[model samples]
Target: MLLLGAATVSAAGQTPEAPKQAPTFRSGLDVIAVDVQVIDRSGAPVAGLGPEKFTVTINGRPRRVLSAELVESRSATSMTAVERAAATAGPPVVPTLPRVVFIAIDCLSFDASASRHVIDSARAFIDRLPPTDEVGLFAYPYGPKINPTTDHAAVSRNLATVVGQRHVPLTQFHLRPAEIVDLSAASSSANARDSSLLESVVVRECGDTPDDTCRRGLMLEITGAALYYEGQGNAGLGMLRSLLEQLTGITGRKTLVLLSAGMIASDTPGGRPDISELGMQVGKEAARSNTSVYTLFLDTTTTDKFQAQVRGADKNLQAVGRDSEILGRWLDQFSGEAGGAVFRVQVGSGEYAFNRILNEISAYYLLGVEPGEEDRDGRTHEIKVKTKEKNVVLRGRRWVMVPKRGAAAAGTVSPAPGPAESASAAPPAPPRRVVPADIQAMADAFDRGAAEFQRGLAGTRDLANLLRNFRGSETPWPNAPRRTAVFALELAVAALRSDNQNARDEGGRLLAEYNVRLRQPGDADAFECAWLWTEVTALEGLFMPDSAMLLVPAAIERCPREARLHLAHAIISEQRWLRGTAGAAEVPGILERYQAAVTFSETAAEARMRAAWFLFRAGRLDEALALVETRPPSGTDPYVLYLTDLVRGQILRGRGRFDEAAKAYRDALATWPNAQSARVALMTLLLSRGDRQEAAKLAAAVETAPADQFDPWWTYWLGDYRAYSSIVAKLREMTQ
Candidate 1:
C-alpha cells in the first residue's frame, strides 16, 4: 500500500496577476500539484518516474495526471558520473523554481546541551543543500528571525545564539502517588474532575498539616505555573502560524523543520485548550500555505548520575516520567497531523535522524492532477495516489487546499475567514518608510533619555549628557528647527521636575533659539509646526499646565487647518480646567476645538470617540451618548470601534443603566478579545450584582490569558505615543 502525503502545486511558467474582485466557485479547471516520495525496499530514493506510471484520485474519484517530474538535489560528493549522465538524459529540468525551507528553533523547550546538539545537526543539513535553495530561521518564544535567503553563513551565525535559553520547569511541588493516579484515571473531557485534582495538589503541597496562609501561598505558585505553560504554548502556535502566512505569497513547495525538546500539551485543566483542536487549526493553515511541518524531537533527559540521584531523592521520578510521556505523544500527534513525520533524536543519534529527514525532502516527484468542478469550492480536500510500479513505497501529504475557481486562475491562496481575520477586519496603517542614519541615531538617543526619565534617573547631569549629542557638530536635517525645539522641551520638563535651576535655564535658552528659528519664513512646514505644537502641549500638561495655556492659541494660528493641533489644544484646555489652573470661562473654547477637530479630520471615527470621552469625563452624559449613538460603518478601524464601545459602556454605567453597559462591554470584547479593559469592567459589574460565580470565572480566564495581549486603554491618555516612532520615521523619510 502506498502511504501518499498530498500537496498542491501551481503550474510552471505561469505568473497570474491578483484578482480584482471576489472569486467565484467552479469557473474553470485547476491543476493541483502533489509531492510524492518513492523509496525502494532498501530505503533508497526511486528516480525516473513518468506520468503514465502513477494514478491519482480526489474524494475517491479517479483523475487524469497532466505531468510527472522527478525533483532531486544532492551534494557534489554524493553523485557519480553515471548518475549525472542519467539525470541529464531526461527532459530539460525546471529551472525557474527553487526550494524554500525554514528552520524554527523552539528555544523555550530545549536545554543547553540539547540545544547545542540540535544546532550541530542543523548546520550539517544546511551544508548538504545546493546553493540555489533558500533558507530561513525562526527562534520560538520571542527570539530572532531571518527571512529566506541563500546565505548559509548568516544562518549559522544565528544558530549560535540559541543556546542556554530554555525554560526550567517548576520543581517546588511534587505530586504524590494518589494525586497522579487520580489525574490519570480522570477522563480527558471531565473538566470539573481536573479542576478538583489541581486544588487537591495545592492542598497537599501546602504543608504536612495545612493552614489558610500556607494554602494561599501554594495556590498562587501553582496558578503562576499554569499561566506560564499556557502562555508559552499559545505564543509558539501564534509564531508558527505567522511564519506560514508570510510564506503564502512565495511560489513552489516549502518546508519548515522545527527543532525542540517538547511542548506542554496540557499540564492543568482550564489553562489551555486540548492539543487535537490546536493541531487541526495548524494543519489547515499549513495546507492553505502549501507548507509541511517536520519536527526534530530532541531528548532532554540527563545522563549525569548526580542529577538523576537528586531527582530520585526528591521523589519526583514518577512525575518526570509522566511528563516525558505526555510531551512525546504531543510531538507525534502534532507533526503527523500537519502532513509531516517526526524523527526522534536520542543521545548521539542527532545526525542520523537529520540525515533521514534530509533524504526524504531532498528528492520527490511533483505530480499534477486535475480536479472536478465541485472540488474547487475553496476548501481543503483529502486525496489518494497509487503507483503501478511494484516494490516501492509512497509518502506525502494527505490533503490539499483547493482555491476558488477565479483564485486558481490568479495563482494565489484565498484565506478562509477565521477569528484573526474578524479581529483585524479594518484597513491596516501605511508601512513605515526607511529612515536616514542621522535621524535614527537621534531617535535612539531620545528613547534612551525617555527610559531614564521613566526610571527616576533623569537628573540635571543626565539631561545635559543626553542633550550634548544633539548640541554640536551634527549637520541639521530639513526640519531641524522643530526637531531641536521638541528635544529642548523634553529636557526643560526633566529639569523642572528635578528643581535644577542651572539646567532649566540652559534648556530655556536652547528652546528660545529654536523657537525663533521655527517662526521664521520657510524654516518649517505646516506638518512640522503642528507636530512641535502637539509635543509641547503634551509635555506642559503633564509638568506645567500654565505654559500650555499661553502657547496653544499661537500654535493654532500658525496651523489653522491642522486637525491634530486642534485636538491637542482641546485636550490641554480640558486638563487645565480640571486642575483648576484655568477657569470655567475656557470650557466653551475647549468644546469648540473638539468640534472643529472632529469636523476637519479624515479619521472622524477616532476623533468622535475622543470627543465622546471628553464629554463623558465632564459629566455631560446626554452629549456623550449622542456622540457615540451613530454606529461606525462596516470595515471601519477596529481600534476606533473598540474605544467607542468602551467609552459608551462607561457612560451608560454611570447613568445607572446596568444592562446596557454590560452589552456594550461585550461588544467591545467581540471586536478585540485580547484587550483587558472591557473584560475587567464586565467582571466588576458581575461582582456588584451578586454574581460571584461568574465573576470568579472571568477573573480566572483573565489571569491565564497571554501576557502580551494589548490593551489600548493604557495609551489612550498619552498623545500619539503609540504611533510616535513611525511618525518620526516618516518625518526622516520626507527630509532625506
Candidate 2:
C-alpha cells in the first residue's frame, strides 16, 4: 500500500505549467509486473532489452508485454568508460525500484557454529548490498525481528546477536553403548527415518528380547521425538508464513533470504500430518506475496566425540548425511517453487554463496504483462519469461498471484494526471454512508465513554443516561454501526458490573432495546448480531441462565466465520449446562463448538487450552492431553506456555499420570514462577504423593513472590476479558 512517486515542478517564482497528457505508468491486477533477471554467459546483467525481445506467458498462454524496464541497482552500475559512453547514447536509465530484503535465520535449525557462520554471511551480504536497498532481519522460532529499513548497520548488528543463540542442542538424542546400530536401511521419509533410528536405539538398549516395559519405553521415546520434531517444523513454517502474509500488504517485490540448517517436512505414520504440505503452503504464500525465497542451507553436521560414541561413528555420519539430503531436497523445492535458488553453505563457503545471491539480485527487469481474464481468478498462475537474445539467461518468478476481479480496484492508485487530463476529468464522487448521523453520534459518544472508563476518569453512568432517551436507529442501519453495537455491549457489560442500581437498570434497558432492534426485519448485521447475541447471552447467563439458553440457537444462526463467537457459544452453553438449566443433550453441541473454534482459529492458543480444559472436565483424558500437547502458536508469550503446561498437567493428573503431571506443573512454574495457581497445584500434587519437603518449599516460596504478579489461570474462564483494557483500546483506535 506504500506508494512512492515523483513530480517535476516549476520554480517558486513562476506559475507551474501542466503537462499535455497523463503519465502512462499503470499497475494493479490489470498489469502484472513480473521481475525478470536476464543475465549473460558471464553472469553480468544484460540491459537495454526492449519489449519485442521478451516473450511472457501465463498458464501456458501468451500474454502481451506492455512494458519492460530494467531496474538496476547502484552497485551494478560499474562499467568501463567506453561502455558508459555507449549507455549514455542509449535510452535514459529508469530509476531503481526500492529493494526490500529480509534475512530470516532459523535459530532452531542450526548448531552454534553454523549459526555463527550464517550470521557472518548475512552481515557480509548486508554490507555489500546497495545502500538504497532496505534490509530487514528475522531470527526465527521466537527470535527478534527488525522491519525493513535502509539502515544496514542496524540490521547487521541484529544479525550478529543470533550467532550463539541457536536452539540446536549439542546432543539431540542420546544412545547408550548397547543402543549403537547401523541405520543404513532407514526409510527416506524424514519422520520415518527418525522413528526407525530411535526405535532401533531403544530396542538394542533393551536387549535382543525386549520386555513389555522396554517396549513401552521405546514407543514413548519414538512418539515423543516425532512430536518434538513435528512441533519444531510447524513453528518454523508458521513463522515464515506469517512473515509472508505481512509482506503481502507492502508494495513491490520482496526478497526473503532463509538461513536454516534444515526443516522436517515429512509425515509420521498414523501420527502428525505431513509437514511437507505446510512447507509447500509456505512456498505458495511466498509466491502470493511476490517474494523470492533464497535459502542458504547451513551444514549442521558435527564430529564431537560424545555424539560419535553414543551412536557408532559410521552410523552417526550416515544418519547425518541422510538427514542433510532429505532436508536439502525440501529446501531446494521450497526455494525453486518461489522462483529462487538454494546454496549449500559449508564451512568457509558462506561468503561465496552470499556473494552469488547478491549478484543475482543486484539488477533485474520489471515486465508489465497484460493478464487474461482467467488469470484474475484470485489464484497464483504459472508465469514464464524468455528472451530471443543469444548467449543469455533469463530468471523470473514461476508464479504470480493475480487479484480477483474487482478486488484490485480497492486502494489502487492511478498514475498522476497531466494538465489536459486533469482539466477534462470529472470530479470525484462523494463518500457513501449507511448509518444515520444520530447512530454515528451515539457510537462516537460510547467510544468516548469507553475511553473515559479506560482512563478511570469517569464511570458508565453518563453514557447510560445518554442512551436512556435514545432507542434504536430511526432508519434501519442493518449492518451499519457494528462498532456502535460493540461499544454499546461493552458499556452495558461495564454498567452491569457496577454497584449502582440506576446503572444496572439502564444496562438492562439498553440490552432489551437492542434485543428488539436486532430481531426487527433488516435491522441486524450477521456479524454484529452474532457478537451482540454472544455477549448479551453471556451477560444474561450471569444471573438468568434460562433467558441466555433461549437466545443460544438464534446466536448460532447469526454467527459468521469468527472463532471468538464460536468460543463464546461453547463457554456459555457449558456454563448453562453446569447450572443444570441445560441437559446432557447440549454437551455434544458444546464440544462441537469448541472443536469448530479450534479448527477455524489456528493461532487461538487460548481456545485450544479452553477446549482441552472442557474435555478434561468431561473425563476425556486422552483427547484433552492430545489437544494441550499440540504446540501453541509460535511466540515468547509466557502466559500461553504457562497455560498450555497448566492444562496439560491437569489432564495428566486426571489420568493418574502423577509424575508427568508434576513435571508439567513445574514447567508451567518455570515459565511464570510466581504463578500461584500452578505453584499450588504442583504443591498439592506433590503433597498427595508424599513429597512433603518439596511441597513445603513451594508453599514457602509463595510468600516471597511479588504481590503485583498476575496469574493468568485465575481469569482463564473469563476468556478474552483477560485482555479487556487492550481490546477496548484497540476497538477505540479501530473505530476512530
Candidate 3:
C-alpha cells in the first residue's frame, strides 16, 4: 500500500514502438535526472557551459538538446521575487507541498555492516536534500512496506530497527564482516550450484535458479508481499502498473536513489545461467513508469562473478574499481540502454568513492527538451548535449526518452533477464531496433482488426497477419536498445483475437513452452499488450468489448501477474452478482472475488478503490467506508476520487440516511462538477420528490452536455425527469 503513493512506485515493463499516433499518450511526465559529474586532471564546476558544453547519447547516437539548466532551487529561481514580496507588506503567501523522497531499506542485498553504513549515508543524504523534500521509508523485504521519513527522529528510529534485524542466514541483512568476506571470496555460487557442507550458509542459501535464490526467508520478501495483495485478488502487475501509470501521468520530476546491490529480478533467457527475462521487463516497466533507478551499490564484496542486473551495467561502469570483464561488458551495455550508471567502491583506496559519486550528482545537469513525438511508450532515444569547444570533459543525461511498447529498442538495448536461469546455458544476444515500417504496420493492423471486429467481419487470418507481420519484423534486439520485449507479446494478443483457435492454441503452447521469450520489459509490442490489457480489463469494465472476452483468458495467462487483467476478470465476475438467476451462494463469491481483485493490486490503490465500488454493490457499507478512508488516494486522479465518492454516497444511502446521502452525492458532485453519476442520482431524487421544476432543471443540465460525456445511467432517469418537466412546462405556459 505504501508503494501506492511513493514517488517512484508504478507500472513497469512493456514493449517497443515507432512513428505514429498512440492509441493513448501519457504526456506531462517530468523526469528528475541527475548525472555524476567528472572533472579533468583539474577540479572545477565547468560553469559557462551551455547545452553545447556536453554531448548526450543513447546507444552512442545523438538526440536534440532541449533546456539544459543547473539544478537550481526555487529560492534561486525566485530570489528577486522573494525580496520584492518581502518589501510588499500583506502580500499573499503561497503554500507549498512537500516533494516526497522515498528511502527504502533493502535487506536482501545489504549485510549488517553495509546496512549501518547505508543508514548513516541516508541520514547525510537526507540532510543534503531540499527542505521541501520530505522523505518516506519502505522495506520490500515483505513487499514495499511504508515507513515514516518525514520526522528525522522516525527515520533514525526505523533505520536503527531495520539494521538490528541481524543478518542471519534467514535474514541476510546482518552478516558479520567475516561472513561478508566469505561471500566476497566465492567466484560465484551462480544460480545453479552444488554446495558442499563446508560451503558457508550464504553460498548454500541462494538457490540454483535466481528465482529460488532470493526466495529464501527474508530476501524474497517482495513476492511474499505481492502475495498479500494477490490473495485479496487485487494483487496483479496492473496494481504496480496503474500506480506507475499514474506517476507517468503527472508533470513533476522525481529522483529515486536506490542504496542496494544490483539484485535485479532478471529472466534467464533460454535456460542459460542468467536471470529470467522478467528482470529487464521490470526495468523497462520502471522506465516507462517514469522512475530511473540510481543505484548506490553497497560494497559487501559478494559481487565477484555474480552479475546483479537489477540496476543496469552502464551504472556499474561509473564506479572506480571492482570489474569483472563479463559483468563490466554487461553493465556498460545495460546502463547505456537504461540511461543510468553505477558507482563502485575502489577497495584499499579508502571508503568506496561515495564522496566522488556525490559530487557527480551535485554538479549534474538536467536537460528538458520537447520530445518530437507525444507517445509515452518510453522508447529509448539518444540525447546529444555537446560543448561548442574541445578539451572540456563532460557528462550529462545519456538516455532521456522512455520507450513505450518496449519494441526492440531502436538499437543496442540489453535488458536483465527474469530470475529463473540455468547457469550452464548460453546468454541471449542484446536487443535491437525495429524498421520504421514494422510498427506502422502493427498500428495499421490493430486499426483494421478492431474495425473488422466492430463490422462483424473480422477473420482469423486478419489477426494472424498482424501476428506474422510482427514476428517476422524483428528479433529480440537486432541492434541498439536490444530488448524490445513487448512487441512479441502484442503479437500474441493479435493472434489470440484471430477467428482461429488453432492459431491461439499454437500461441498458448508457445507461451507455456517459451514463457521466458515474452517476458522482456518495454519490448514495444509486449508493453503495449500489457497496457492494452489494463484498458481491456478496467474495473469500470473490460478494455476490449465483450467480444474481447474471447481473447481475455489467453492474454491473462500470457502475463498472468497483471493486476489490470484480474480487475477485468472481476468485472465479468460482477455479472454473476447482478444475476439473481445465480441465486444466493453465487453473489458471495462475486463480492469476494471483486474485493479480492482490487486488494491484490501490488500498489494497492487501483484495485482497492475499485473494490470499494464492489462492496457498495454488495451492500457492505462499513467496509467500503473503511477502504476509502485507509486506501491511498491518487490525488491527481480525479476519476478515482469521483469513483470513491459514488461508493460513499451509495453506502450512506444504503444506511437509510437519505438527506446525508443526498448531500454526500452533492458534495461528490461539487468536487467533480461534471460527474454524470452524481447528476443522474440528483435527477432521480428530484423526480421522487415530485418537484417537476427541479427535475426539469436537472434533466436539461445533462441534456446539454456533450454526447461523449453522456452517462448511460442518466438515460434511465431521463424518462422520469422529462415526464414531470413536460407537464411543468405546459402548466407554466398557461400561467405565463
Candidate 4:
C-alpha cells in the first residue's frame, strides 16, 4: 500500500513578520493490485476465505499479505484514497473499483444484422446488471466514444442508438476497385494495368464466369472482401490492446466482453500474418492489469455448409478464406492466458452468454500481496497462490509486470523537517504579483495555438496541453489571474467541442465559480466583461442559447464600450434568427450591434463579414453591397478574408452574374488556396454554368484533403465541406 500526503500553506490572519516555509507537493509511489478468484470442484465460487488461509509467492519469494477481501455486488466501497489523490492535477493513477466492464461492440467486423442482435443482447444484460457495477460501451475498430455509467435507463437508450446506426470501418485501407465509370475515363492510367491483371487471373484460374463483366465483378468482390476483413481485424486488435494497457492502472475485476464472430484471416500467409503476436500482447497487458478478456463468438455467419462453400470459393479466388479454428484458438489463447474463459453463443442465446460473463465478474476475490525487496525490480514476475484446504481449486492471474516505482511500507511515518523549514525559520518571503508581460505572452501563445488548430495544423492533445500549461498552479505566471480565468473558459469551450467529458466537467466547475466571482464587489469592469464574454461563448458552443441570451444585456451594460460584448449580442441575435424564434425585425438590431462592434474594435473583419452575409441572406442587396465594398482593402486573417469573398460571391451569384461570381470565388482561393469553402462554392457555380470538367477537377482536388483540415466545422451545419460532399456525390452520379 502507498502512503500519500499533501503540504499546504495558509496565510489567514498571519503577521507580515512571521516566517513560513513553502509548501512541497510530492508524488506517490506506484502500487500494483491483483484480482484473484477461487472456486470449488463443482465450479462454485469459494468465499469466506481470509488472508491467512492462503500463501502468496512472487518470483519464488513469499511476501506478506497486505489485505485480502472479497468484492461483491451491492456492497461496493466508496472512492479509494488513491482515487482522491488522482482527482487533482497530477500524474494519472487509475483506481480500481469493485467491478468495471467494457462492452466492445465489434461493429467493424460484424454486419448490420449481426450488430443489431448484439446491441439487443447488450441492452438486456445492462438492464440486469447490479447498480454498483460500472460499465462503459464502445464501438470497436472505430474507437468511437466510451460512455461510462451506472444508469440502466441511459445505457439501454444508448444501446438502442447503437443499434439504429451502422458503423463502417474507417481503417485506412482502400480496396474498392476505383469507381469504374465508362472505362474511357481511366483507360490510359493505372486502372488499365489493374484491369488486365484481374482479367488474366480470373479467366486463367477460375474460368467459372462466362463474360468479362461477370469475371470482373466476381474478382472485385473477392479482393475487396479479403482486404476489408484483414483491415478490420487488425484495427480491432489494436484497439483491444490499447484498452488492456489502460486498465493496468485500475485494481479491481476489469472485464472486456468482445461481441463479434471472431478475428478474420486470409489463407495467404503474406496477406495476413499469424495473429499470435497480438494475442501475446493482450495476455501480457491482461496479466499486468489483472483484467479478463471474454470473447463471445456471435456465430454471425450462415450455416456451416454454406460458409464452407463460400470460404472455398474465396480460397480459390484470392488465396484467402475464413478459418474458424484459427480464430477460436487465438480467442482461447487470450482468455485462458488472462484467467478468463471464452463462450460461443448458441443460436438466439446472446443474452445468456452476456449474463454468464457478468455473473463471473460480479463476485471475485481480490488479493493484495506486499512486494519484497527483490520484487521491487522492474520485471515480470510469476505469481503462484496455494490454498491449505483440501479439494479446492484456484484461478487468478499467473503473472504481473512489477511497477518500477515501488510504494512505501503501509505504516511508515513522515521524516523530520529539513534545515530550511526548521524551528529557527527564516523571514517570510514577499508576495509576488503576476507580471503584465506574462499575461500578454500567454495570450499570444494561446492565440497562436488556436490559429493553428483552426488551420488543422494542431491536434486536440496539443490544444489541451497548451491550455493546461496556462491554467495550472505549476505555471510561472504570478500576475494576471483574470487571464488564467479566460484561458480556463477557452479550455472548457474546446473540451465541449471535442467531446472530452473529464475536461468539460472540470472546466465547467471552474467557470461556474467564476460566475460567483463576477458578482463580488471591487472587481474591474473590464474583467467582469471578459468573464461574461467567456461565459456567453461557452454557452453558445454548448447550444444553450436561452442561457446565453440572458447574459447579453447585463454584459453590454457592464462594458458599454467593449466591441466584443456588442458582438456577443449580435451573435445571440443571429442564433435566435436562424432558429426562427425571432422575427425579421430583429435584423435591424443585429445590424446595429455588428456596425457598432466594427466601429469600436481594433479589427472586427469577422463581424463585418457576418453582417454582410446576414443582409445578403435577408435580400437587402443595396445595404449588403455597400458593406461588402467597404471591406478594408486586405487583411492578415485569411479565414476572415475567405469568408468576405465567399459572401461577395454568393451575392454576385444571386444577381445572376455567373462570370463575376466565379471570379470572386477564384479570388478567395487565391487568398487561401486551402479554403475548402471557396472550392466547394466554385464547384457548384461551375456546375450551374455547365462547366463539368472544371467542377470535376475541383471535386477531385478536395476529395483527398487531409481529414484534420476539414474539422472544427466538420459537423453538418457548421462545416462547409458537408456541402462539398453532397455536391461531389451528385456530380459523380450525374456524370456516371
Candidate 5:
C-alpha cells in the first residue's frame, strides 16, 4: 500500500531541450559506475566539477574513463535520464543497478520543530519526480512499509501521512516481556515493560522533532504478535522475511530511507539488558538479504566507548553521537563488502536527518553491460567497478563470482593462481573461464526434496523419530563430518518449496519436531536440528522450482577442510529449548543455528547470509534487514537478497514513502521478476498512481510471472492495510 512517485516519463519529441540523441559509448568497451563524496582533504562533498576533472583506478592501476557524470540531489531529470538510459544499455557494457539507501531518524532526542522539518524534507523528496528509481522508507518500532513500481502522486500522499504520524505509539512503544492477555496485564506487568517507555514518551511523543509513526498510530493502533520473551528468539523476523521475499523479488535495486531512534533494545529491571542479542539477530538477517543499509543518525547517543566520529559537512551524522559508531559498524560490515558507503549525519548537527536521507535516496551512478557469461551453479560473483577518476570514490560490487557452489569455491586462486603463482602472479582467471560447474545436482535435489516434502515425509511417529534420529547429538551422518541437522533441514526446505503434500506436511512436521527439541534447551546440542530446519525451510522459498536439498547440506557445512567437524552445532543449550512444539521445531532450530554462527561476522558474505537466514525465520525483520544489508555480496544472494528487498520495500511503502517502496519492489523484480508479491506491489503502485498502462503491464506480469518459492505466502504479503493506506494517501498528495 506504500505510495510511489508516478511522474510521467519524459516522452520522445517533447522538448527541444532534450538531448538530440543519447551520448553514444564505443562498442567492445567496458563501463563502470562510480559514486563520489568529492571534497578537499577536509572531506566535504565537492560539487561543480565536470567529467574531465576525474581519474579512475583499480588495484592501484590507472584506467580509461568510459563515462563520467555527477548527480546533484533532487535532480530528478538527470536521475530519470540516467536510469532510462541504463535500462536500455546493451552489449559489452551492461547497466548497473542503483545502490541501496538507509536513513535514520532520532525521535528519542529531537524537539518538535526539528522533527517537523525532517518530515517536510521527506515530503519534498517524494514530491520530486523521477523514472526507473528504487527506494524504501522505514520508521522504527512500527515495522517498515513498502510499495512497488510507482509514480510521484502516490509518494506525495504517503509523505503527508508520514508527516502527520510522527509521535504516535507506532513510532515508539512500551516494550513488554510478552503479550498481555488483558487490560489488567498492562497495568500489572510493570517491571516486565521497558522502563525506557517513559523516556520514549517524553522525548519522542511530546518533545520530538518529528513523530511520523506515532502520529499515524493515534487512531489506528497497531495490533499483531507482541515480540518479547527469550522464546521469540529475535523479534518477529519471519513476518519480515515473508514480506521481504516478495519485495526483494520486485526491485532489482533498493534504497532504504529509514528514520529510527536507535532503540533496538530490551531493558530488564535490575538485570543486564540483552540488546546485544537483539543486535546480533538484527545484524544476521540484514546481512542475508543483500539489502544495502545507509543511516542518517539523528539525535541518538551511544554509551559504548566503541564510538568514532568523523566531522560531517551536511550535518548528517551530528546528533547521531556514538550510535553512528555501532550503526556504522553494521553498515560497513555488510555494505562495505560490496564497496558501498555508510553515510551519516554530521558529528553534532541538527539539520534534520531527512534532508541528507533524501539526498542519498535520490543519488546514484548509472552504467550497464550484458553479462559476458552465464554460470548455472548459482554462483554469486563479487563485482568491482572502476572509473577514470583521481581520488574519486566509487560505490559498487567488488567482484561477482556466482558459481555452482557458494562464493568460497569460486576464484580460489587468490594469493596464488591455480597450482603455481605468486602475489604478483597472473590474472585470477581468464574472463572466458568465469563460468564454473553447472550445479545441476544441487538444483535437482532441491526440486525433488521440495516435491517429496510437499507430498509428506513418513507413515508414523516412529518414522518421524527415525528421520529425527538420522543425525544424533554425537553422530555425523552420511557425507557430513559433523551435525547433519543443517544438511537435513536444507533438503527439507527444498522440498517445501513445491506444492506437494510431502513438502507441506512432512517437511513441516520435521520443522515442528526440531522446534520442540531446540526451542528452549535440553542437552547442549538439542538446538542443532531445529536451527537447520529453519534455514532449510526458508531456502525452499528462495530456490523456487529448483530443489535446494542438494545444495542445502553443503551450504550448511561449507567450511575449510581444516575446520572443526562440529561447526554446525547449535549454540543454544538443550536444557533451555528442549520442550517446544515438535511440528514447528525448525523455527527454534534455526535461531540456535543463527546464534551459533554469530562469529561468522568474521567470515564471508555467504556465512552472513546463512546467519541472516536464521534471523529472518526467527521473525526479526528490522534486525534481519540490518544484517542482510551487511554481507559482502556478489550481485544479489538470490532468495535472501530478493526477500530482503521485498520486505524492505513493503516496510517503506507502509511508512508512506510510496515512491521509495515502489522503487524497492521494482528493483526486486528486476532480479526476480517472477515474485508475485513484488508484482502485486508494483501493480498496486501503478494503479494507485493512475498510470493505467504501467499498472496493466505490472498486473499482466503478475498473471504471467513464473512460480517461486514464496508463492505460498502471497496472501499474507498483501494483507496488511497499512500498505494500502500509504498508497492512498500518497496518491492523493502527488495528484494534487
Candidate 6:
C-alpha cells in the first residue's frame, strides 16, 4: 500500500528514511533548514531576531548560518502565491511558501460521549482561524473527508458527517486465519488454549510440516496481537507517514495538529507489542519535510457520576497518563527532531493548545545552514542551536541525517538503521520481547474464557472471572474499547442465561448506568444506534424482555434507518409471540422488520444469520435455508462459522433430512466442539432417527457439561423443547 514514486531531494537536501534501503540525496546544494521557536521569560513568543544572534552546531562541529528569517503566518494572499508558484514549477521554478496545516481527529482512540466534546472544541478552533489558514480535517483513516480548505461551511459539513456516524466501532482489519492461529500460539505457550481437535485443524490447514508451521505461527501471533490491540491508531500512523511524504516537494512551514485521546504506549504493561512504526517514521519525515507535529490531548472530563464510572472519568484520566508518557517520548522525538515543540494541554483547554500552536507557527524564525564537506560523510549530523541574549531560550532540531557522498545520484534513501541494524541488535525488538509469566497466564485465562463463551461451554462463574480479570488487568482505553464493551455485554448475557443473581444484578446495573447517561440533555440526540443496541442487549441479557421491548419506539425514532434497532425489535417480538402474549398476525410485521434489519445493517452477515435462526425456529425451513445460503461462504470469525453450520442443521432437521442434519450438527461441533446448541441438536436428531444409544450418550455428556455453559433460554427460543424435555427425562432416569 505504501507506493514510493521517483524520490526527490528537498530544496534543503534532505531525504526521508526509506522503509528498506538507505537513501541518498540528489541536490546541488547542501543547505540544512530548521524551523525554530524562541520565547522570552514571560512565555510570550520572541520575534524579529536576526541571523547573527544564533549559532548552529552539527556532530560536535560548529557550522556557519547561511540565512535566518522570521516566517510569520501570512494571509490568504500568500497561500495563493504558493499555488501559483507550484503551478509554474519545473524550469522557471518560483519557490512556493505556504503554511499548510493538517488536523487529524482520533475517533477510534476515545470514548463516544467524550468525542463529542473533542469535535465541538475542534470546530471552535476552526471557526476562530484566520481565512489565511488552509486547514484539512481528517477523521483518522477515513478522510480529510474535506481536504485542506479555507471555506468554513465545507469543514462543518464534513465534520458533521464524521460525528454523526461516530459511535460505530472501527473494524479492525482481519488477519489471515492461518496467521491468527500462529499469533495465538506465540502470545504464550500456556495461552494457546487449543484442544487436541483444534491443533489437528491447524495442522490440516497448513498442509505441511507442523514444526515449521509452529515456528512461523509463533512469530505471526505476537505481531498480530500487537496489531489487534493497537486499534485504528495503526491506520492513523500510516496516514501521518503518507502526509509527510506528500509534503516533501512543498516549500515553507507545515504543521499537523493531531487531536485525540492519544496513541497506546509501545511499552504497554501487557505482552502486547507495539506494532506501529509511526513514531519513528513521523520523526524522520517531520525532519525531512520541515513540518511540526503538535499533538492536542482532548480533555475528556465529565461531571456525571454514572458516566464517570461507566464511560468517562477514571478511564479518561488513565488514557491521559498513558498517552502523556507515549506522546512525550515519540512526539518529542519527532517534533523536536523537526524543531517543533509538543504541548500537553489540560482538560477543557483545547483553545489554549490551539493558541500555542498558532503563536509558535506565526512567529517562529526559519534558519538555514550549509553543511561542510565532512558533514556529508554518509552519517547523521547532530545539530544544536543556541542564542546569547539573556532571558531568551531557542528551540530547534538537534540533528539531521545527511546522505553519503554521491549517494544522492542513486535518488533513494535507505531506512535508517533499526535496533537490529544498530549495535544494540543483540536484544530482540519489543514485539519479540519474551512475554512475562504472569502476563502470559492472564492472557491464557482470558483466551480460555473466550473459547468457552464462543462454544457456549462456559458457566456464569467462568464469564464473571474473565470479565473481572480483563477489567482488572488489560484496562481498556484508547486501544480496546470495542473489545471491552463486547465482553462486558457478553458476561452480562451469560449471567441472565444461568439465572445467577449477582450476574443479573451486574447486567441490570450496566443497563441502568447507560440509561441514565442517555437521558442527559442532548445525549439521546448524540447517541449512536450501536450504543442503543448495547443498552437493549443488556436489558435482554438481564431477562427484562418487557423493558427492552418498551425501548424500541424511542430508539427507532432516534435512529430511524438503523437495522440493529429493528433486529432488536424483532427478537423482542418473537419472544412475546412464542410466549403467546402476541397474536399470530403480529408475526408478519416482525418478519418484515427482520428482513429490513438484514437488508440495512452494516454487519449484514450477523443480521442475516440471526434472521435465519428466527425463521428456523418459526418452522419456515425453506426460507431459513435460502437466507443462510445468501451469505458469503467464507468467514474469518469462528462464531459466525459455528452459527452458520448450526443453523443449516436446524433447517435440514425441519425438512426431515435427519442424516444430513446429523452431519451438519457434527460439522458445527467440529467448528466449535463445546457448542451446546450443536450438541443438543445432534442428540435430538439421533433420537428422532431411533438411535437411542447415541442419543443417550450425548444426553449424558450434556448432563455432565458445566452448568453455566448451557443456556435453556436459547433452547426454548430455538423451539426444540420437545426434544429438550425428552433428553432431560432420559438424564433424570439415568441419574435416578
Top candidate (TM-score): 2
Decoy 4 TM-score against native: 0.41
Best by lDDT: 2
Q: Residues 1-736, candidate 2, lDDT per residue (tens digit)?
A: 1111123223223344432222244556567667777777556667777778889889999999877666555432344556445433433334444678999887767566656766787898899876767898887654668988999998888777775333321222353211211221232236543665555664565666655555443343333333334444555665677677777755565788998877544422333213566577677777767786789887654432234434533345666665556556557767766777788877445887787777666667777688898888876788888998899877666877677766753222234344355446653332222455544565555546655444431433365454443332222333555555566566566666667756654555455334433342233454555555446444543543333433444455555555566666677666655665444556687778777777674436766787788788877879888888865655646777898999999888988999999989988988887799999999999999999999999999887778888998876656555665555555445444
Q: Would you list the C-alpha lDDT of every candidate in the order shown? A: 0.60, 0.61, 0.41, 0.54, 0.37, 0.52
- What TM-score does prediction 6 earn? 0.44
lDDT: worst 10-residue window of model 5: 219-228
Error of 2 at 625 (Å): 35
How does residue 574 of candidate 5 score in lDDT?
A: 18
lDDT of 4 at 143: 35
| lDDT, model 4 | 0.54
lDDT of 5 by residue, 615-647 (tens): 555556566556545324556445545655666
Give the RMSD in angstroms, all C-alphas superposed, for model 4. Answer: 20.5
Tens-digit lDDT track for model 4 on 128-219? 77665667777654434464556667667766765312223221112221111112222324555476544444554346553544343333
Clashing pairs in 2: 265-276
Tens digits of per-residue lDDT for model 6, 307-425: 41223122344543443465344445556556666666544456666766665555466565667888877555567888765797676655475666555511122222432344343
Check candidate 1 and list the clashing pairs. Answer: 5-396, 5-397, 6-397, 6-398, 9-33
| Global Cα RMSD, each model | 24.6, 20.0, 24.9, 20.5, 28.1, 19.8
TM-score, prediction 1 = 0.47
Regions of model 1 farther than 4 Å from truth = 1-30, 40-43, 51-55, 60-62, 75-78, 81-96, 169-171, 175-224, 267-273, 302-322, 347-349, 386-393, 409-736
Cα error, residue 548 of model 3, in Å, equals 39
lDDT, model 2, position 135? 91
All candidates in order of lDDT, best leading: 2, 1, 4, 6, 3, 5
Models 1 onward score TM values of: 0.47, 0.50, 0.34, 0.41, 0.33, 0.44
lDDT, model 4, position 76: 20
